[model samples]
Target: MNLVFLYGPPAAGKYTIGRELASLTGLALFHNHLVVDSVAAVFPFGTPAFRRLREQFWMDVFEAACAEDRSLIFTFQPEGSVAPDFADRVRQMVTKAGGTILFVYLTLSHEEQVQRVANADRGKFGKLRSVDLLQSLQADFEACERAMPPPDLTIDTGTTEPSESAHRICALMRDHGLAR
Candidate 1:
């Protein structure tokens, strides 16, 4: 179970780095937006119904991934500090995949987050929301910071290039003996 969880503020390149990480390790990428987009397509954004369905779906998928031997890299921006056993299910997943879990978090300045949100003209996910630049990105980052397992790797994405960050993540994964 090569499970690597990538979390960060919007446009902090969680998805991009997660991709590279997955590519390096041959893990599957289950990005945050995939769930949002699938649910939103049927129920549109901001609907309570959509939220329930999406959350439920993700839980099941996570569990199933754990049951099956699959290397997975998923993204999440939780609402607050993670539970003490936050990595339990993920660890199970990685074990199933014949590997271990790695937790990677990306941090950035509020100003950088706001700037990116404003310039995030390319994302379908961003265009759907009405949150002001700072609030939206900051809230998610705050949540992830609070809720995640102690990160195995944390990078200042604001100061680093995406590829560089990804490379460092790979190094962390290797150094931590997470590679199968």
Candidate 2:
């Protein structure tokens, strides 16, 4: 099993690139919002129920995928202070299951992130759509990045096309001998 963990601030094109990566690599896509939106549908965000259910659901999916030796691409937001250990635990789980994890960080200029927040497509996934909220989140993500270990690969979506970014990520996986 192989897990491609792609993370970045809102509007950093994580999902866009993940989709392309999955299409190219045949890895399953498990973007963050799938669980977020589902859990939010029942429990409110940040509530105890939401947190517990979200964590449990994520764990179950990951464990199942690892056990099945499935390769996957997962997109996430940088969770520096809020959930610093989350990614580490996931990595441990994957390695324990004899799987490889590749961390990819996607980013772009803050100005572009802010501008992209209001795109109609974002709302389709219940994504953050406010410029102010995006700015705040990006600051937090920056701090998180400084505290976290560097990713296996980093792409600037503002300069690179999504397809190109995906290709770079796929290349990294191939170089690591995790993909064909």
Candidate 3:
């Protein structure tokens, strides 16, 4: 039950590369939008109810997967300048399950992030599709990155194609004896 946690700002290519990594490594990809979109379907975004529901759903999935001893690739964008307790929680779960965790942070230039956010071809999840919304979120992302702990690996999506990034991640996993 290994956990590969890929996190960064939205449109940083976490989901895009995660899909490729999962396909290559045979791990389940659980992007943040999987829970976000489901909860957003019933409740308005940013409401307390929506927040609680989203967390509950994420925990449920993580718990179930850990219990089953399954490897997973989880992706998310950490919110502004608060140390991510979620990583600690995941560490505890995987440790209790006798598994290891890997952290991969994806990064992109502000310009590239804006471009990706504006591209409609990206999946229609609960993400902010408007350039205005993304511009605002960019500030939050910068703050989050400053406060977050260094990741095991960092990939710059602005310079790397999704497939190449996935390959690099896979290579790192293998080097760390985490390859499945």
Candidate 4:
């Protein structure tokens, strides 16, 4: 299984672009919020139970998908709130399963991200909608990025349409031996 890991800050279009990328590549889309929202629904966010369940779900899915050789496109927002070793753990699992992980970092200007965060579609997925919250999160972006694996491909979403970005990602995956 090969993983297309889309790493970016919120409102940088990770999920939006992941959908397009999945459509183009035929890979399953697993946005971070899928587990987050489900767990948050049962336990309060940030509580120990919430964190533990969220991590368990992520690990289970990754393990199952890798063992089955199911390639996936996963949307992620790297925040300091999570365990620092989470990314490394995911990488190790994929590699142990003889899979390649392509890290695609998406970014946009702060002004653009702030504007995009307020879109009504975000609320449907329980996305952050406050400009103040965005600002606080973005303030830690550089620090969060420092801990991530260097991106195999980087795209500035502020200037690129989702389809175009997806096209670029697909091309990268093809070059890296993923046919689609």
lDDT for position 141 in model 1: 50
| TM-score for predicted model 3 compared with the true structure | 0.92
Best to worst by TM-score, what's the order? 4, 2, 3, 1
What lDDT does the true structure give each of the candidates?
Answer: 0.70, 0.87, 0.83, 0.90
Model 1 steric clash pairs:
1-94, 1-97, 1-98, 1-99, 80-147, 81-146, 81-147, 82-147
lDDT of 4 by residue, 4-51 (tens): 999988899999999999888788999999999999999988889998
Residues 1-180 of candidate 2 have per-residue lDDT tens digits of 789999888889999999999999888999899999999999988788888888888889999998889889999886542467788889999999998899998888878887898899999899989887766666677887665546999899999999999999989999999878
Candidate achieving higher TM-score, 1 or 4: 4
**lDDT by residue for model 1 (83-141), tens:** 33445655655566566777788888867766666655536554323247457456555
Which is better, 1 or 3, measured by lDDT?
A: 3
- Pairs of residues at least 3 apart in sequence or in different chains that clash in candidate 3: none
Kindly give the number of clashing pairs for every candidate: 8, 0, 0, 0
lDDT per residue for candidate 3 within 9-94, as digits (tens), equals 87898888999999999899998888888888899877888878888888888889888888899998888422357667777888
Find the number of clashing residue pairs for candidate 1: 8
Off by more than 4 A, model 4:
none
Ranking by lDDT: 4, 2, 3, 1
Which portions of model 1 show Cα errors greater than 4 Å? 44-47, 80-99, 126-133, 136-144
Candidate 2: worst-modelled 10 consecutive residues by lDDT: 77-86
